[model samples]
Target: MPTPGVDRWTFGVAPLAQTVELAARLRRVTGLALSLEHAAPELDALLDALAEAERRLAPLASADPAPRVGAAVDGDGRVYLDHSRHIGAFNPGFPEYEIVVDGDQATGTVNFPVAYEGPPGLVHGGFLALFFDAAIQHHNCDAGVAGKTAGLELRYRRPTPVLTDLRFVLTRSLDGGRIRSTGELLAGDVRLCEARMDAVQGDRARLPPVSPRREQPGPV
Candidate 1:
């Protein structure tokens, strides 16, 4: 079952999976572009090729991203694109991570690519916060419940390195009708960051249902 207020698809969605993979490759190219150096000497040809690709694609797609937001398509229970998901199964700019859930507990791994660097080879604190929020919500959804983020708090212990596999674990519990979750990022035995989040379990029944037939939304 898809988590309330968070998940829209549960993988295996036709074309959805394929598009996500393409987005990932796009991310990889962007990361490489950011880390390119003069020593590589291949940047000119790369940039030219990329520009040509963009020009070819420019007419096929819109520059505005709002269409994807709240857009609906039939898939695993009618996929609705929620660009805010930090896991970036769809969005290319968000932090990328893989998570696994077992009941209320979940564990995941993330490697902050070069494009996410902040203070000298370290992952940005802002991005780490985003990762935790997404991971926590992901756990909630997988646990058969979910909601909007009411509050999130993160503590940075040691600098989180970019391009290194970091482990994160989160546990969720119910506090009255609200959901509470806590998680940590670890570098081997060393703790890198910790997070505590609170979310209001919104009534999924009250949430708007997907409208798959609507065309792309335009400005009013």
Candidate 2:
């Protein structure tokens, strides 16, 4: 069985925050590299050199790293401001978006870059769902409803455009520890997609919590 309270994919908050910035820069590099993949063959040498450098650094980078902690987690086990997989933060796998909450509603605005394209000049359908899911989760969190995503449904009304600013809005209501939420993605006034999410709020005691370490141990 897997060890309790351990998520290898997640990192310590401080280190992850620094890595999040690095990931953002790496994301830009990725976009440029993809754009240039079809260009002159001479660039292959440069890409090869870059890849070799990364290969050499990978092992040293992760060797004996500090243990991961739950610093960004709350008393109720909610992870906030975790930039790695928390799409709400500045992680580049998901569109970088900002949210503003007013009462039970949360509105977000983001721009899809060319890297997120599926069809020519259109945002990928899967990314659209991710955008809505993150937005709805943010809404639930801001409304003081701590929960996990139980189920989600999305409708693609039209192809979402890439390389343009888009807006997303979500709202949630709690009923018997379950949050029923809905959201919409819009390009200007045109609705591109809509989504519904079911989140189940449970007691924190059900989880095995990990506390943050304040001091690092000496190397053996």
Candidate 3:
């Protein structure tokens, strides 16, 4: 019997088997050829609704002034920053760093503080890169793959304020055994940054294999 709560439309006995079954089922149900170029209104609507809900409830639900999850670690590493909660906030003045990982895509937001300013009240460029890198890396992680920053290209169109809402989106993952991702940072309707990044599968040797070693080296 199929596992409870597992949708026949999305999964099967085996994960790979489920993909094939889902594809066939989709074709039969929609009567449309499946391709990246195709867009489904229903699916789009659902995704939009989810994003909207996330945005609306972010402030209230994430107002807890505590660190629930740490930074991205290979096998569970923990790191904290003051703005961590602000980045993943489910409530106002909170962090919305929590990502919605879906296959090859991931999306999240962050609300910076005045302390993050570089020029007057604008966010620093280095900080923007950090946010972009983390979001992209998290995308890969959510896909069951961990990737390293092989290369990153960023363009700053406008200055991002320290105390403002920033929306991030990651997309366009290529095959080639390596994951290639792109992201964007937006403040309201204005685009602040555009970034493209390449990440390879998480390998121990490539990403400092040991987590505890780095976490605590015991006094050199």
Candidate 4:
């Protein structure tokens, strides 16, 4: 059993609003550029601009010792931690997915854009495993008990298509000091993959304390 109202790890940490915005913009740009069949010569100037931006921010980034992994305060004065699908405030790699928890079950919808395609419009297998891990942890964190993943097993049942709407469902159980979660990635009625995980149950108060971060950089 877990304590009620105890602090749990969360997502949506909007640290440095401008920086997050820049990350979103970079994400969009990366998608657009990757989908293009040929590169425009004009992009050379864009590359140069990006290089200059990187050069300018390098020193400031080196000076900042604060880690971006843990908790941080957002613009609204509320505290949040960014272990969600979006990852860190400046990270644009992970595709954001929707999830909702009710009792022992969690349901979510996600779309894999073209950027995540691996084989002829199919999402890469590795990313599917990543999604299961994140989704499981997200479910646990939201359910008031969570822990480190002791083990994870994934089975690819079918080719998961990209640029399409997909759904995921997870059900968890607490047993003998461990959290056991099982879930599947589905496209409509078809199951694309299945995940089973064993995790060591953890306490909310055991999560790391919030730390200060400076020099949060925008897209560079």
Candidate 4 C-alpha lDDT tens digits along 63-127: 43444434433222223436733452355666668887886798999887766779998999888
* Shift in Å, residue 18, candidate 3: 41
Model 2 Cα lDDT, one tens digit per residue, 74-141: 33232233322346345677767778767568787888777788999898998888877777765555
CA lDDT of every candidate = 0.74, 0.68, 0.57, 0.76
TM-score of each: 0.76, 0.74, 0.50, 0.80
lDDT of 1 by residue, 106-168 (tens): 888989888788999999999898888877876776676778899999999999999999998
lDDT of 1 at 202: 69
Q: Could you tell me the lDDT of residue 13 within candidate 4?
A: 51
Query: Taking the tens digit of each residue's C-alpha lDDT, what string does model 3 give over 64-153?
Result: 443333233343323223221122222222222546656666677777654345788787888788777767765654455555578999
- Cα shift from native, residue 5, model 4 (Å): 7.4
At residue 167, give the lDDT of candidate 3. Answer: 83
Cα deviation at 214, candidate 3, in Å, is 15
Worst 10 residues of 2 by lDDT: 1-10
Sorting all predicted structures by lDDT, with the top scorer first, yields 4, 1, 2, 3
**Comparing candidate 1 with candidate 4, which one achieves the higher lDDT?**
4
Better of 1 and 4 by TM-score: 4
Of 3 and 4, which scores higher on lDDT?
4
